[model samples]
Target: MFSYCTDPDTLSGFSWLSCYLTTGKHMAFYRAFGTVLLLLAITAPTALAFGFCGARAARSQVAPLRWFGKIYIAIVRGVPDIAFFLFFVIALDQAFEWLRHQVKCPDWDEPIRQGNDFVVCQIAKMPLGNAPQWVHETYGFFLAILTFAIVFGAFAANILYGAMNTVPHAQMETAEAYGMNRKQAFWRVMVPQMWVYALPGLSNLWMVLIKATPLLFLLGVEDIVYWARELGGSKTARFSDYPHPDWRMWYFLALLVFYLGFTKVSEVVLDRLMTRLTRGQATMGGEAQRKAAA
Candidate 1:
């Protein structure tokens, strides 16, 4: 960006490095970091909501709802996660386009799948072919978020279901004795107390979620991994400025450090949160906290 950066060929040492890092593509690389954070921000709560509903269904008194929940958890857990990621992105995309095709081109007489190609009318194309580049990117990111949520939600549901059961049976009994209905007891007594049990599992899930962010590359989102591979590859004289040898190892090393730092910060925060949530509860951690305060 500097005036002197006009001649990168003459630039050397830190000057060349500075000009190289400040290029437009590097700016995009920096923005991709925020995209990773954005994915985490959107996915975490959505996954939790999905998990909550799944857990509630699993615990439902109705037979069908309970079975549905059990099937969801079992099916997701049975398959490798990468398989789901690959399958769901394409599946969800086609499902959306199919709905659009049905709505927009109701009279069209063509099968959506002709051999290996998934063809829909131009209007049914996701984000439309004429749409801005950002629209395409945003659509891809949204699909990635949905994939992450669906996969993580099943695991979170299993954790939450177990946590709900770990809540003492007598607590519900006391709530019922006080004339509260099942739903009231569940909300006012069981749900409130289950977090202490669930925190450890949820914390572990959070770390897994963090590690899984790299999978965004597989879904075609321009995530850090994609940018790392792009920016770290060897550049010849035929290319524009900022030529460099293959530095993917160093780029990946930076990613490793970033993830390690993120996990370390998360661990510290989760520990404090666990301590806070556990305090005054009728659990071992609560007992220890009480003793320490005394």
Candidate 2:
């Protein structure tokens, strides 16, 4: 991308490597790594929020709300992730476009789904056909994030729902005896105690979520996996600057290291968090801390 790097064939040694690394596509590749991190950063909390709501709804007094929550959690958790990711991306995009078409082109009468093709009015396209490339990319990335949140949210809901139940029955009874109703007891007694039990399951989910980030490429997002293969594969003289032999093995090896390091760091942080949350609780962890002090 640099001015001096324009004539790549003439360059060699350090200059060739420098030019090759700074190409426009390579810059995009670097940004793709950041994109993966961004997806994880955004998805984790969003999924947690969704899971919290779903878990609460699953335990709701109202029948319809409880059914909705239970079904949402069941369907997502029951489906294989690869199937869900592949299907949801297309389903979500079409669902958005279908809604847009209903609002924007109500007079246009045609089967939205005709045989294999899912069609919408031109103006109703999710990003609009005339939108910039970046807009299209952004829309795809946002959709991937939503799909991920929905899937992981269900997983979290199942874990949290169980965790809520795992809290001692005595605690809820004590709260009720102290003039707290079911609603008050749940918020005051059950919710706080659920986290210690929830931590272990959620920790596993966090690691799985980290591993699943590579699926961004499957969702049509230009993610790190896409770039790793693109940049690392052998490039002929006509195709790329500073042509290289196959290096995908090395590229993926780096990815392996990145994930392992990330998982290690997550384990350390979660262990400390679990210790803090378990303090003074009736669990074994809490009992040990109590004994240590005594």
Per-residue CA lDDT of model 1 for 106-134, tens digit only, reads 99898888998999999999979999998
Q: lDDT values of the candidates?
A: 0.93, 0.90
Per-residue lDDT of model 2, residues 131-235, tens digit only = 999899899999999999999999999999999989888889899899998889988889878888999999999999999999998999888889989889998
TM-score, every prediction: 0.95, 0.91
Candidate 2, after superposition: displacement of residue 146 in Å?
0.8
* Whole-structure CA lDDT of model 1: 0.93
Pairs that collide in candidate 2 are none
The window of 10 residues in a row where model 1 has the poorest summed lDDT is 71-80
Best by lDDT: 1
Model 1 error, position 136 (Å): 1.2
